[model samples]
Target: MIVKTYQINGMHCMGCVNKVQKAFISHNHISEADVNLKNASVKLQMTNKLQLDELMDVLKNIGDYEMIENESEIHHNKFQLSTYKPLLLVIGFILFVSILSSYKTSFQLMNWMTNFMGGFFIAFSFFKFLDLNGFSNSFATYDIIAKKWKGYGKIYPFIELGLGVAYLLTIHSAITNTICILILTASTIGVIQAVLSKKQIQCACLGTVFNLPMSTVTIIENFTMILMAISSLIFDFFKQIIT
Candidate 1:
């Protein structure tokens, strides 16, 4: 009866909590595991043959989350995130600002901003179609929604570009801002999707050049982008009727 309790760490939300759970559930040797985000510990009932080396290997790849044998060393791997998450997050922010910039004093400035946001997204999404392991990989997930909704990954980016173009052509702040905010919201959903799937890989947002860590920065950035996008969406909704 070798009952070993591991000191689990680096869980911030329900998504983080589930990732840890998935890791444990994947293994067959353990009788049961009770993982509490608040407690940050794994209660395992084992038969004394389990090796610590194997356990350590599995924990290291939990995306930004890290596991250490020594409880005191947990901080070393805590909240580590991938670089792509933040990079893509930044790209999303730029698009968001572009919508507001479209509302500048001069109509010419508005046109420039809208074109910038739309054209870039279209180009970026086009190139992204070539990469197999990038954001497109997330679409391969096995959940009901992802499985049922095929080809959806390819539609979102192009749609965003079209919205930008329409807004620019019409010089409609309501439409432009609404579209920008929608993009932001969608990106935030990406973060949620990753968390839910227990995905711990490179975000693949920067086009596969940088191998960054997936840490708390990525999560926080996702949240901030969502907030900004939501504000833009609301303003658009109001502008539509008022103007």
Candidate 2:
């Protein structure tokens, strides 16, 4: 077995690092791999020697980010992430339109539609989270927890539905506050996990619908939700307090 040393570039954070590592192992012949963000390097132990062209191509496929074979050896645009860029843009725009619709119309319909959209986002992420491979990915811990915890996954969609319904059914300040807190708490945990894992990997959050960069978007999107919910909650709370 030849132990080949390769470096992955353009990895800005832990998520970038993990995604590059996955790119390497996606090739079946690779026996093992170890990556370090500190050095921005990847070490691969291959089953046997292979064609250099094949090796380079496979590594490039795993990541649209840059990968360098050696120092001063730069590969430019080995893959195109531009395709996914449009998808993320669409997700953002749709979110904007959805929020805007609520502002322009009756508050009740706004609340109902927004709740459904938000719930659908969470439910969609929940499904992609399940598609994870536990052994290869760090974030796959959710899957393990869901499996052992039993019913967590099945129950979560229902919880999200409940949150949506609560918002739709009543103007309870407490309920809105609860929803905001729940979203914030969950997003905070997601950011913490992504940071701690120290690998660049697809967030798999939006699934195939929106190929947004996993970076801050996931956390940010949830943060926005939490903030909106919190704002609604605060307003409701004050209204209740005044009444």
Candidate 3:
């Protein structure tokens, strides 16, 4: 068995690894593949000779992946930080702004959570709008609803934008919070399944612009919004009870 190593680009998570491995292993010439997400490379044990073009064709069928044979440089740790910097920066900015926005109101917990959810939806939706088609394709790779109905991926950003506006305007509090719970709960189920199944795929949470990998962070992002909505609803219910 001849072992060949190829440097891969655009692999941000284990989901990407799973997809790449599947592509290689499905081919008759490729006996086994060891996909290293950290290193962004794949080691393939080949039972027969295969050309670079052939391997490239297999990846092309999968998604947006670039491969280079004979390039074995590992910068997995650095790659993670660099890859997720955009997402982290956006999250930090959203949190900071959300907190700042509530300062004038004396930092009421519910108000702060409202602003945070608004900021989260608006900011995340902005990214998705950048490349709607790309985001839809990537999102469909894992999102159960999107996978079944491609139109859901296309319209999801608009839904988020609407929710953001609703929260920011503080309109229809009960309805808005309820929608948040339902929408995010469905999304969280998909994220949890993708992570548990170890599918190597890109995360569409930040859209196709950032090469964010499918991971636990994506799960937390979904659950955070869900929790915020649930907490706000609970607080309102108790306030109503006291009054």
Q: Score every model by TM-score.
A: 0.42, 0.48, 0.70
Worst 10 residues of 1 by lDDT: 137-146
Candidate 1: pairs in clash = 64-80, 80-214, 80-215, 81-213, 81-214, 81-215, 82-213, 82-214
- Candidate order by lDDT, decreasing, is 3, 2, 1
Candidate 2 local lDDT, 1-243, one digit each (tens):
335566766667888777767766777657677888888777776543334566668756555655556543224213345635654564666566556656766667436445544544555445444532321132233233443554454454445546655654545547655865764465457555754563333444443233233455556656666666666766666877999
**Candidate of highest lDDT:** 3
Which pairs, if any, clash in model 3? 14-200, 15-199, 15-200, 15-201, 16-200, 16-201
- Evaluated against the true structure, the overall lDDT of model 2 is 0.54
Candidate 1 TM-score, true structure as reference: 0.42
Q: In model 2, where do residues sit more than 4 Å from their true spots?
A: 1-90, 96-139, 142-151, 168-173, 176-180, 208-213
The better candidate by TM-score, 1 or 2, is: 2
Candidate 3, position 3, lDDT: 57
lDDT at 33 for candidate 2? 76
Cα distance off (Å), candidate 2, residue 233: 1.9
The 10-residue segment of model 3 with minimum total lDDT is: 71-80
